[model samples]
Target: MAESSSTVGKRKCSQDRQVDEKPVPKKGRSLCSTGYGIAFTMHMCNFIVTAQCTVINITMVAMVNSTDHRFQFNDSTEGLSGDSSGGLNNARDTLPAGVPVYNWSPQIQGIIFSSLSYGFIPMLFLSGYLAGRVGTKRVVGVSLFATSLFTIFTPLVTELGLVFFIATRIAQSIVQGSVLGGQHALWEKWGPPHERSRLCSISLSGTILGTFAIILLDGMICQTLEWPFAFYILGGIGCVYCPLWFVLIYDDPISHPWISITEREYIISSLADQIHVSPCKQPLPIKAMLRSLPLWSVCVCGFTHQWLSITQIIYTPTYINSVFNINMRDNGFLSALPFLVAGVTGILGGQLADFLLTKNFRLVTVRKAATFLGNFPSSVLLVVLPYITPSYVTTMTFLILSCGLSSLCQSGIYINVLDIAPRHSSFLMGATRGFAFTAAILAPTVCGFLLNQDPELGWRNVFLLLFAINLSGLITYLIFGEAVIQDWAKERKLTRL
Candidate 1:
């Protein structure tokens, strides 16, 4: 996508000059902020939503093979600790007595894993447009509740057939696309300019924590009851969360019933002039956005980051199990541990970015530093992971460090969307995420193909590709990314029909 000038509205050059003439103000803080409450709700929403997406990763191992079909692996393949496809045999034995299995190849499994994003991508822009008009609170509530119900029924869909299961997954994700962009809209109304990173990152970190908690829970649930129970349990939790959301969430601080006077004043005052566009009415500057290299540059990182992230979220459990013969329960613990670190670092990176800005660091400087520090080490570590195969302590260390560091790029790339265009934050989020999420579709299929082509070197090839992508992404952002709002992104007075 490229930005070019279009005649949606004439720019108010004089008004823009007057606004810029006002003295820069000091940042404000309040003792009791309602924004934090909304942020936390979005955080929990992230957790449950992401958990649903990743639950299949753990359960797929059980779906594909049973102890009855021991040699799922080719004879030349050196996997399963030398026990005739050891991972599947143990996974089968670990499950409760009656679960059925399918004879799906790695390529077929890749399509299944990548299926959700296929639906999610197209719905992102449409849902975001709807949320801006119908209200995020309603859109998000319906979406969260529906996806939860779908998750609860995932196993039943599986019984229907492979195509049905994939369809169900896609349908579930289309609902989730609403929740993904809704929070960015919330931030435009509630977040103070100075607190943007901290607030947004706090909510976003829930995605990492959700992935961690679900993987851990999936193993235990699979061990105790069965694979289907993991979906039922998490889905049940999400259903319960839905009611709390409706009671608590509002579009903006002014409309929130529980917001204290002082906090409301603080938030409204702090964001008084920064957010100018009305997403409900403003016609996006499509040509201008198309021309904005900075926006697209940040988007590049979004793409590359998702490439690595989707790979980790979808395949980590299988990788650990297949390569090291880790049992289901232990595999869960190992796969989840890295994400826990990532969650912490995500918040820390946000705080760090905010601190640098508060202390007068150039916005581009902070962005470049975070982007480089975050991606470089992680890319190197991912590539190293394949080289140092099966080294238990070292492998775990690298994985954790890589995940933890890579999270900082969220602060760099994502928040920049709001930085340059708060007026279009939700729509931009949907657009950029739509672009980024294509990686989610590609990563699994590509990984599946690589693994299928050369079982022994497939994992190596995957990591090497991620490293190249990450490096190129960082270089792009360093060269073109900017923090200040672009002229094309300026608020324009739109004529309503």
Candidate 2:
């Protein structure tokens, strides 16, 4: 993962020269009708935050008991007033205590639902292309408004069969992807170049923070009211956000009257030399993009790291309850620690990566260091976990630290997208996420299938599987995971054969 001297020289000149350049005023770019674009971006950011929260809250509750498999919305009804006559009551009967929640049916359903989040990537990949043909502001505003509507209706689909549940989740997923993809494209139009990472981190961090809010609030609601109420409350909150987006978001800094002149110049000058591609009117070379080794490496890296993460986030409560005999409510509180830690670590990790770059460290060196710090140790810990015989609190402390370290991979994977394919960052992100999410769909089912094979031994096997995949990723990083482009893309152009 070392950067070549030539790459370093090129980057130094490009970055340093840009750092010292005079600002370019964006006087001609209209600022008359951009309030909605600015407001929409912020609004979309907030919606993602809420969705992430809802995901974690519902997942934790769903897997807690085997026989009385209550969905969150269902649980809320029972908690709020003991009126569980609908699908909630029916699903509850199916999930009585002592029944293992890791059955085939729920496993399949979990895969489909979780895939919604990952599916957002493809939606985003196309959005840039779509926005270019249409208008950027129009695409974002309409999509955000539609997405919020779906988020609002998610809880209302309180049916017993799997169709309603999966359909609602799929609908939510499509909308979520639209908002994120649209927002990213829109932000690229407006965000300052040097500050892109920091700004992107801020927007992404909202997701993590929103998740933290959901976990704590949902936990309280689950304890005091019910799980369905958690969704109801989230849906209600989401409704309020849609209007705000319509009121505030803008497509580019220059377009927004509210943005200061200094801010607009700084933004335009930052990316003056770089291509500001409008959406593709021509079809994207998705196939060509997939064939590139550098891009595929990004996909494998994300797949490995995300698999480990999604598994932990979705199943940690199950692990705590089964392995240490902790109660559901206590597990919810303790389980939230890792996500919060990850949120903090995500910010720290991004800052740390930036610091390394500022010190003139090789891009490969910085990214590889972060990748190793995140994945390698977590792999080792998964192996060692089986043998730990500590108290419940001590054991979960290990779990918390294990997940926190994984945030390094999250930061590394994201930054690496920009480093390797700056021109196609959005497309690459989409392609990588599409491939990696197959793992997301698989993690739960694999865990379930394995556990079902031998309840006593399957859990241990799951850890081993996680360890193996993570190690495979570590080796990939060691061998082929460079952050600097190293003329890989250039070679593709020259050797077009």
Question: What is the C-alpha lDDT profile of model 2 across 1-497, one tens digit per residue?
Answer: 78676565444334212221334232322234232235335534644544543454344444333412322211132331212343333333322333223332435545554645655656656665555445456665666556556655554553444567566666666666665555555544554433444445545555555655565555556555555555666665666665666556655676676876765765666655443433322335556665666666667877888778767766766565455433345556776777688777866776676555555666677678878888878767766776777466667677878877887764566556655645445455555655665675678778767765565566678889998998887777667776644333222211112
Worst 10 residues of 1 by lDDT: 12-21
Q: Could you list the CA RMSD of all candidates, in the order they appear?
A: 5.3, 8.9
Provide backbone clash counts, one per model: 9, 24
Return the TM-score for each candidate structure.
0.90, 0.76
Judge candidate 2 at residue 114 and give its lDDT.
Answer: 66
Candidate 1 on 204-277: residue-level lDDT in tens?
A: 99999999998887887887888888889888999999999999899988788888788888777676666643
Best by TM-score: 1
Alpha-carbon lDDT, every model: 0.78, 0.57
Question: Which sections of candidate 1 miss by over 4 Å?
Answer: 1-32, 66-89, 277-280, 492-497
Question: Compared to the true structure, candidate 1 yields what TM-score?
Answer: 0.90
